[model samples]
Target: MIDTLLILHLNDSHSRIFPFGPWTNDNKRFYPSVIRFAYITDSLKSLYPKHLFFHAGDYSSGDFPFNTSVGKIDLKILKLLGVSAIALGNHEFDAGPDSLYNALLSENIYLLSANMDTTSHPLKTRIRPYEIFNISSKKICVLGLTTTEFNDINPYQKPIKFKDPIQIAQIYQDTFNNLNCYLKIILSHLGAYVDTLLAKSTNYHLIIGGHSHTRIDTIWKVKNSNNDTTYIVQAYEHFKVVGKILWNLTNNKLIDYKLIDVLNSPNISQYMIDTLNNIKSQIYARFGNVYDDSIKSLDNPISNSPDSIGCLDIPTGNLVADAMRFQTNADFAVIETDVLVYPLYKGKVTSDDIFQVMPYGFDNQNAYNSRIYKITMKGSDMYNVLGFAQLIRGSVPIVQVSG
Candidate 1:
């Protein structure tokens, strides 16, 4: 029997095409990453002749150019790169249904989501619960499961309801059992913990997970009811890594699998390099000469001391609370200072500085009805909330202060 090699997954690429670092002047450009991925795909196409590419969702929203384009450019890029299917992430609704509809116009890729109810919307037919692909004459069932927390993150997604992911996974598991496919893969945007639970509880052969930006370099094996093993894999955020899974199958059953990080040693193809360079030039030309002057440093430095009139290092939590109060017209506000901004210094502030400080915005009219208040809570409650706040701040860094 011939062994089939399947190159598996990608997750949470927040439209980051350029690599910026802690202290590096040269931008390594995600074009190389793209090129490398393409080269790998081409190699797999030739070697296996049966390749399945799947993304765990979050194709756009976050970076400037991709967000500004409203996922149009991303769709085109992904189409060109040959994405077979993708799960619908919360960020997919960032620009609302219209943008998603536009992005899904092409039928080349399958946009799967078992949880989202789009019957009332125009994109009803575009999103599917699952898709089946035949590779190497083997039937592979692929189902998509999105996070139920879409209600909290996506305010723009109206008339759409999110179902319980676990329930949806069970439904798909039943379907897969009936189908008796060679393999069953669940493309999930429900984060790693949920994915692990799904892998343990359900009959999925493999769980490709995303949303938490976790990079699982090793294949996590979980035992099924019959003592069979299921594989789970997830790549880190950004376009930094591409995950490859080599599945060893025997008698149409998955025996074992190995996960590889293709990004570490990418073989950049010429075509990909050329395409990346063109994109790089276009991006540089578009914004290269534009000068932004909103950011300016104050000559009079504010002290961190409570008594200081002008404090450059005001707590970000305090500033965000104040900004929220002012913006929402709320009588009182509360925020953590660490999230607001870093301390400002030197002669001139730039647009980048302002962006760094005020990355997230508040536009809630309802907040106006409420007053901003700082409450003194018990140590236990404080500890819980503070710990939660710290975790959130770590994942999504925010700067509340301007100066």
Candidate 2:
């Protein structure tokens, strides 16, 4: 008898409620709206009834609508799309572990992280290390692993120890083997490089990865210690693509595998559009009525937001510098990349959008004030500043300049 299983995967979606694009050919030009994504996933479910939908993390903390609602909208959207299980990404802890726990409690979605020690965590019982899925009577085990890089970026309220993923994976593999699982899959948010490392160290059959947000069009095959092959795949970020992996098995034995693409799924249902519009209205309701006429009717996109671009020299960075130079009339303006918190979309720019982009606080007050200082500096000192700026690269504290 022949049995088939389909695995649909998403990674690093980053709370993109709506699609914004016309990206360069070198980049993924098309990104579907939330409704479009839901429609496509629902259609896939209809076509392939025995499918498992998994997200490899970083599904939150990019869009203003998702952030303002404290991830409530993101949760609802995921629930609507029918996500099976999700791994913890570094951004999940952006609002702290308590916020993460609370946000998770609102939904019934399964959270997975195999190597994170949750003894001191507030929601220890809620996060499971792994989960088993029975696809067409074939038992498949999925173990989750989050990047230790989360600890470096965000502050957790309690001691959440993250063990070595590779080490812990070996133990999980042994356990799953004893259960007679047909295949072992690792859903990971440890980025592409670490995913490769884990594939080499463990006897798992497939790894669905995120965090680096690279568009990998091909399956990465690596030979494990036992000389068995491990396959890895990651879709491009922000709902640009849905990865569909097909399994062809005969008598519970794997025979072949292939990847299918469901691309440019742009048609959205009226119901989803109405639901998203309601969410957007609520987000706009929270705006403080601070209007800047200069930015109103600004429908032309300066560039894709930093979240979409994922690199420096973005239009948002340049906008910050221009604002500083225009307001302060400084000889030169230099603003750090981190200061621009969100990306600019291709539609009408609103006051709420400005706050999302420039949100920062110190001592319970919004402290992002535009100020100018005049001082005499030696040419050598200015050279040092410029030299230090160049040294900062790749999501570091590089300065954007304008005069």
Which candidate has the top score in lDDT? 2
RMSD vs true structure, all candidates: 7.6, 5.9
TM-score of each: 0.72, 0.78
For 1-403, candidate 2 gives per-residue lDDT tens digits of: 5566778889988777664443335433245456677777777788877778899988876665555665667878877787888887776665656667777887655579988875766666668888898876778888999888645444442356578889999999999999888878899999999988998888898899998886788778889867988888898687767777776644543444433343555467677778877776776566443322226545565642443534556577788788878887777777766556556555556554565464432111212222345566776887798787777664453767776
Residue-wise lDDT of candidate 1 within 1-403, one digit each (tens)?
A: 7576565578877655433212123423223345666676667667765667888998866444453356666666677667789898877776677667877774344589998865668776788998888766677888998888857655666657688888878887888888877788889999998887877778777888898888787778888544677778888876666777766554555443444454555476677667656665554454441123334555743322233444323443454556777776655555545333233333444433333343222122321111234455676775676577657766442233221
Give the Å shift of residue 34 in candidate 1. Answer: 2.8
Supply the global lDDT for candidate 1: 0.64
Task: Determine which window of 10 residues in candidate 1 has minimal summed lDDT.
Answer: 361-370
Worst ten-residue run, lDDT, model 2? Answer: 361-370
